[model samples]
Target: MNVMIFLLLSIICIGLIFIIHKYFGKEELYFLAIIYAIVALMMSFKTIKIFGIDINASIIFDSGIIFILYYFIRKYKYNESKKLMLSILICMLITSMFLITTSIMIPSLYDEFNFSYQNMVLDNLPTIIIYPLSLLITMSLSSYCFRQLKEEEDYRLIKTILTIIGITFIEVLIFIYFSYAFMIGFKKALIISLNSYLAKVILMIIFTIFLNIIFKVKKVKE
Candidate 1:
């Protein structure tokens, strides 16, 4: 029953992302939204246990927060920090702020040992801050490598970024709905988290590719 439900939910999530990319794709971050969805799905399991809350719902909320963060950093350009609004540097700043805040708010969630406050401040605090920043760094690195190799003014960049953004929004909705609609426990959270990671990333990647093709057509008309 749980597996069936997950499969169904995965399909619905995929469809929703597709529609969002189609309609809201002013540029191409719509496709990149899927990457955010993929990351959320990956982290949803162990993290669901973090605050003793619904893992899926937390994923949705965190992703929403990231969106808002991304919006502000992009809109304000945060002290001329980025050449393009969607530059990798800006994305890092947005993602880092949220991750750092999340770390501060809910530290020591699943720690089996009682580390002292002093130790937490010196050791754990850096761990909390560094790990997430590493992820953002890796993503930024990937973007940089691509940018350096490709034509700087190419349109593909926009499409790719938009796809990632679309992935982010849809995953947020999915986790929010599932956490509310279903009663899930630790063991199930574990299993579903794995399923979500697998399904969401693979599906989003495929859908994002399709969205790119669609946008290519639209660009021609314009």
Candidate 2:
């Protein structure tokens, strides 16, 4: 069931990204990328079991953001992708600030929901801050790596696979260490980081292959 849901969400996310890019143009694609990043950050707090391994649910949306970055870097300029990354970073900073302030506010005596809201936000505050920071770092490194690989036309697929693995591993290490190491200990956090990297690489590979097929088909049609 977890595997099935993961695949379904991965397909939906990849499909929506290409569809928007196909019909809407880069401006809208940028908007969608920002939304994907923010949603991924918010969803990072929930873990789901896939093949008995625990992984964050946000991998689906994170894969979407990665595809957007890859698409822009492959088809447009690296600077354009940088613009998208900057936009996401700014938005995430604003979001974290808002969440922190809201979570710290005292609820009124008659309030029925504010406490729960505060608890949820404060509990996941580490993720709220860490997820985006990790994502931005990954985006920066991945974009640069992809840009370099762009010149290697003979090994596109191999380079793509390596880029995904390398970048996602970095992201998992940073996120898991800072977010979980203190609470769960270094050894447990390292184990979870490895699992998360595996899960992310799987999702990213699926998304990247699907995206390549879509663009190749469109190119053939054109």
Residue pairs whose backbone atoms clash in candidate 2 = none
Off by over 4 Å in 2: 219-222
Per-residue CA lDDT of model 2 for 76-171, tens digit only, reads: 887798898899889888888998898788788898999788876887877787877898798889888889888888878877988898888888
Per-residue error for 77 in candidate 2, Å, reads: 1.8
Candidate number of the best TM-score? 2
For candidate 1, lDDT tens digit of each residue in 35-82? 553344334333333222233422332332243223323233343223
lDDT (Cα) of model 1: 0.40
Candidate 1: C-alpha RMSD after superposition: 12.1
Best by lDDT: 2
